[model samples]
Target chain A: MQSENLISPGFADPVFQSQAAFRALLTALSEPGLIQQVAPGFAAPEGLEPATAIALLTLADYETPIWLPAALRDGPAGAWLRFHCGAALVEEPAQASFAVIDGAAEAPLLADFNPGTDQFPDRSTTVLVQCAGLAGGDIVTLSGPGIAGSRDIAPIGLRPGFWAEFSANAELYPLGVDLILSQGEAVLGLPRSTQIVEVR
Target chain B: MTIHQSIPGEDTKPAYNYAYLDEQTKRMIRRALLKAVAVPGYQVPFGSREMPLARGWGTGGIQITAAIIGPDDKLKVIDQGADDTTNAVSIRRFFERTADATTTEMTEDATIIQTRHRIPEAPLTSGQIMVYQVPQPEPLRKLEPRELETRKMHAWAEYGLMQVKLYENIARFGEVTTTYDYPVSVNGRYVMAPSPIPKFDNPKMHMSPSLQLFGAGREKRIYAVPPHTSVRSLDFEDHPFRIQSWAEPCGLCGAKDSYLDEVVTDDQGGRMFVCSDSHYCETRREQGHRGTMLADASASGLVEAKS
Candidate 1:
């Protein structure tokens, strides 16, 4: 894992930068469909968005197992993650605490990852997907605990039938994966508790 | 580039990291917090760190505050609804020094509130985060002593034992005798312990605009109730859950709705009930809201002057 291939430093001021990023992530998750900007000043490798990289750097640790698709695994992304975050790379998607899905990669079935048990629903995976853009795509309205009434978001670059799969995943209630969709420097969250409806 | 260092006048070097806990620990706790919010009321296990404060004395809430607090936040700390108490003062000062954030006693001005044993009488608005200090995060701890058994029960949504316990209380006392630390079901799914707050404040947990987070350091657990979440106190149809009420208003602020603290005035069994929330009382008094005690004192003073 020590093989050097131009790995970037974690953060200029690790504490302040990570704290800011964490707060943004919290806001994004707390208010589902809310997009928050994350400018951590870390240079992300190719094929990985800066927001996704910032989220991983702020949330993942050695104890957290990260799953990367073949595209992300073969590139410099895996090494970069291992170098900076010290997160373990898991082979199986279901075993991962966090998983990264690139825009070009096929979206894995939500059931492939852990939805956690009834007792410990928080043990479910947090999926970070790289999107082409956060705005001007298929519009979906979200309503849930954090939302006041409803929030509309349209994330681009997702494969067809993503919402259908998400609808099924949301049915899990207390047991489902939480998603963070990143495009460039913006990230939007869609927690399991959120009720999503296509604006067709 | 050294960002933090001890000055010449300082006795001991300020060696502690910003907000006390290191960045790694904060990240770990932050991840747990996100999950806790995602699944409201579910207790998510985290690596709780040791703070300067003792275990039971709000170490859990301190850790959560430390993880989330930044330079921009306005913090408020309260113990039993009073901002001037020992625990509240110490916690407030701690954040002021470490996080360098502004501290306020007023509930309306605070962005983040860390409280033990009580919720503020004033309603919390949207965007504010309430952190509750919890000694015991498990709602079924008393009923089922075994941790493994209780975890299984929670997994299966087995709350029959809790219902039975409440039923027995009703059968014995003709009403539910339990008052503080009332158990509530979060989002109609996970039954949660809403800290040691009096039953009177339990209604504030339902559909509240502010996000509520609970931390139990000794138990190494963190849980949350997101904004607009449903929190229902456990009760039966025959005897619905009721809050504590008093015939007498606050002796200091003339507030009939706020929770009162019974103060012993003399050894001759004289007592006066005052508002537990000192800030609320002070604010009301400033607005010319006088209680019975104040009225009596002013009247006696006028009588002495005339004589």
Candidate 2:
């Protein structure tokens, strides 16, 4: 693909678009398992979903190094991220502040990415996974800070044993990586405080 | 910093950036806020920037408000629950001049309320965010005085020092003497300092429907208590946590449930009690709630209460 084609139009209005996107992200994160629409509102590369593209646009800067899967690394999404967000794409997941991956195709061990040290868990990498859809999969009940009693979510196309791994991840509270699952234009936040229970 | 265009629909760059903070700085704060929300009570450190005002004031609250604020937001700034205070007025005007956001004195009308030392008397509803100006974000800072030790304590959920302090207060004063800046256990894990709000206001933090965000700019730390989260003030089984009670209702508005402030009326130490929350008191008075001190309207020449 030509370099120009990879560099598609980003946010039309950077300030307002980013603020809107950030609010969406904030609501999703604060209320785990709650779905919020995050629209880039512009043309992006083929590989990047609107939710993922807008998240990266609103958050990732030159300072926040990004880790992408091998296919996306050399593809249009990588170039687009670099061009629009000025993100430094890292080869290793541990080196990145953000790791963008397609969970349907690749399911790397969650531990493979940085969970950060016990002292500073906020330093952990925030994993943004592109899922198949916000719904239509195995249902899991979520309980924790944001939730009142409990909330159920069923994000499709997660790898096998993802809930078991997520259960273990919550046990490492204030240390595990936070997940922002995106599908097309909708996003769901599953932070470290979230407990995924009874996945069937 | 490079000069970047900020205004919407206009190519001509303004004198200041949007909300008076650069995009990069706002992004940094935004990222930190997400982590803070995720952790619930764990203090997430961020790259604190120098504001137009100094750090000791409401800079932390201002920074959080700026990062989250947009043109459409209705902001309400409060200093010790009064909207007309100097700190509140200056910060309100700052947002108006920079972000071009509409400012309101009424708590119910605000989408985002930035406060120092008190939560509003009115109950916070969902879809509203309460940003607190925390002078000291770390609850254990006073006891431990070392960041490294405190971090380890939070990591291990070791809050014995906090308990010991409360125990010490009980031994000394027959109860938990620490009133304002009360320590609370968040989510049964990290112990958090709920700013310098009166002990009377601490109960309001529990299961608040509105999202609560706390920022300490001088300390470069941010923490949160998401809606419906449990925030229990530390206390023993026998000697439970209690809020302050007032014998007399508000002298101006006759509000019995709200936090009260004592005002000296004369040189001979004559005193009267009034609601600390100016807006709340005004709203109550407008509803025709009269106190013992309030002059009777329609029958008296003075509609306003005399000092």
Candidate 2 lDDT, tens digit per residue, B1-307? 3233445677664667778888899999999999899888889998888998999798888999999998778999999989999999999988887888899998999999999999999999987999999999989988888998999999898988889989998999999988799998888888999999988888898888889999999999999998888999999998999999999999999999999999999999899999999999999998999888886765675466555
| TM-scores, one per candidate | 0.93, 0.94
Candidate 1 lDDT tens digits, A66-133: 99987777778898889888999988999999999864456577779999987688889999988899
Computed on C-alpha atoms, the DockQ of candidate 1 is 0.63
Q: Top model by DockQ, which number?
A: 1
Which residue pairs collide, candidate 1?
A: none
lDDT of 2 by residue, A1-200 (tens): 76666468888777878888898888888889999987535565778788888899999999999998988889889988999889999998888899887877645667778888888888888999888988989888998888888999988988877777778888888788899999888999999899876786
Fnat by candidate, in order? 0.72, 0.68
Instruction: Give the TM-score comparing model 2 with the true structure, all chains together.
Output: 0.94
Misplaced by over 4 Å in model 1 are: A1-4, A40-42, A197-199, B1-8, B295-307
Residue A179 in model 1: lDDT: 90
**What tier of docking accuracy does candidate 2 attain?**
medium
lDDT of 1: 0.88
**What are the DockQ scores of the candidates, in order?**
0.63, 0.63
